[model samples]
Target: MQIVTRLIAMTRARKLQRQFQLIERSIVALPVRTRSRLAIMTLREVGQASKCEFPHLYGTAPEQRYMPWGQGTEIGFSRAQSDNAEVALRGIALWLAVAYHETKESPYTSLQPQHRQLLRVLRELRDAGAERDAMAQWMRSGAAA
Candidate 1:
């Protein structure tokens, strides 16, 4: 019984790891500007669903709150409300997408300070090696146009 339970847990972990890897690869393949836009849109959608007032945080508002990644124009959560894991995960993914989009010079270069921080957080959410490998592979593929 113990072995069976351990095997199930390991299988689930592997499945989740694969899912995260796929997400990293897909985001890396997206155009930089498109990924930035998607991050902004995801934040807006998540905020609206969570009932966070965003009169100044959506749709080209000059004072809108945004993540530090990209041009710093993407909307972001104002406060850490609710302990929902899904919302947190979406926010992390959005940040990762934006960072990955910006650092397109090379897999090992051109990452700004903010991008590094965002990548660190993303790696914390999943496997850092897997995320890096996906990004590297995408860069080599030249499909980020």
Candidate 2:
């Protein structure tokens, strides 16, 4: 039985390796510009997805509070309050996507300082509050233009 189980695991591993190889080949088959475009689109989508708030955090109370024990500062954020933090993170993600496509031939290349700064800002916003207003502001500005 043990030998049979080992053989099954080995077979599964081989299948996974083949699947990975196919995916790698598919990515490599695309032209550089096409790949860059895909990266840009993917980044945009991911940024949007990140903005989706966990609805469980929702409540109709005028001032709802939840304490995240580790942080020690009782987080007292409403949907309106967190809007900016979300916007900031999404904006940074969008810029990072642009940087990935425009700056280097490969996405694996070292990030520029500006891109790093954007990442830092995103992290700061994430830590500051959950409303993620920054992400909302970015989306609003884009729509306005």
Candidate 3:
């Protein structure tokens, strides 16, 4: 019985290790911008839930109204305005990546139309070099634009 229990425990541990490795691979496979966005969104959710203020992670409200995360007012213009376009792009990517992982569904199958649209827009920005240009400008100006 002891040997059986030990074997079961070892199997469970190996399974858990594989699961963690899979998640790590998924995260690493994601683009840097997407990872950044994921980190920011995760931080924002945690901060809000815990009522902890993270000024670095949080941004001031945007002049134009827009939903940064596609679903909630909780994550919006502040992130885009505070962080650069790359950060915003990353956040959007992260949001999609997380959604994909959690749902285990394709973006078209699992995500709402709005989210799909948001993803499209962000992807366009990334592909067009707009995000890179904006980041470069931000760096050159030494100020958030």
Candidate 4:
């Protein structure tokens, strides 16, 4: 029974390795080391990166767990915030478009330092497949147009 348990543990580790490799490849197009980051993040990291505290961070450090998702798993984002996050993301996308295309247009011709930072964050998010659907929503909303 001990041997069998050891074998099972080894198999799970192998599966996690493969899943992480696939995740890395999917984010290879990103220009930074975000490709190498694990999909799961700590509550503090999430809150700091997002600049908004999540309700679950109730003074406890959640154990970091590697959750290997299956093929059928679907990704999504929080919606309809009063803070107008979606509009802000869309504006960032629009400014990034102007910069990317080098249209030489005014207004969005030059972005603030933070705008550039957020743009990179968006790229990282999209490449990591965390917000592909949200990216699509921005593209379809014509808010970036």
Candidate 5:
């Protein structure tokens, strides 16, 4: 049964990888200016959602795609926080990287690089913690604790 489940997951992963390739190709064909504007718009949208639940567009990497607006807003908020904002900014950067390739804008007009870097760091920390938590839960559940 476990083997069957693993095989199914592998199939899904392959499908997702193909989809990612297509998304990459589309992004590469976009105009630079449009890309920039898209980033700005995406960030603006993210900022607007700062107070909501699941503010950073959280998702498991293998099964989830980040939303541009949500990522940008998270970065903006991290910037606003003024300290240890890397995680939020990183989320924004990742989304921007994907979005910029598909739009016309320059991809940092609204949010500066320093802030973006901070956001990136914060995201790493957040992801690490989540991973640790997940592993711990799995271990405990399996009587391996």
Candidate 6:
């Protein structure tokens, strides 16, 4: 039945949320500097996969959440086209935000237009699929589209 199929898909989506939360909790427990590095690395990876420049996370409301200033890396974003990049980009963005609370390096960071889109994505990381209301919130983030 259509109802049954919808329920199954919903179940999987919620499960994915929970799994991501578990990942976030584990990642946040690491040292702050390590978390920061990982966050930057995640940003670069997300941008690379999305076919955009790396996101500037420092100027946003959330700001970069640590210490010792992360050294800058100048890597060009280029790749032979691939259809699967979008999938990787989304997951990378979500994971970065999960650790974003630990970000804390600056002096050359400012939000790009795509970064605003990223902020919307970050907003969905909350609630961790703990309730129906939270699940609805995730649905609104357009992550499933």
Tens digits of lDDT, candidate 4, 27-121 = 34433333223222222233332331322122223442122211110111111111354432232222222222221111321223323443454
The residue pairs that clash in candidate 4, if any, are: none
Clashes of 6: 1
Candidate 6 lDDT over residue span 57-103, tens digit each: 22223232232211111011111111354433334434444223212
Better of 1 and 6 by TM-score: 6
Give all TM-scores, in the order shown: 0.30, 0.25, 0.29, 0.27, 0.30, 0.34
Query: Once superposed on the true structure, which residue ranges of model 4 sit more than 4 Å away at CA?
Result: 33-145
Tens digits of per-residue lDDT for model 3 on 70-97? 2222243223333475555443433433
Tell me the spans in candidate 6 whose CA falls farther than 4 Å from its real position: 1-5, 52-145
Span of ten consecutive residues with least summed lDDT in model 6? 71-80
In the range 20-42, model 5's lDDT, one tens digit per residue, is: 34433433443544334334544
Off by over 4 Å in 5: 40-145
Report, for every candidate in turn, its global Cα lDDT versus the true structure. Answer: 0.42, 0.36, 0.41, 0.33, 0.40, 0.37
**Of 1 and 5, which scores higher on lDDT?**
1
What overall lDDT, based on C-alpha atoms, would model 5 receive against the true structure?
0.40
Best by lDDT: 1
lDDT of 2 by residue, 92-136 (tens): 333333332222232222323333543453343343333334455
Better TM-score candidate (3, 5): 5
lDDT (C-alpha) at residue 122 in model 1: 45
Q: Between which residue pairs do clashes occur in model 3?
A: 33-90, 37-90, 37-91
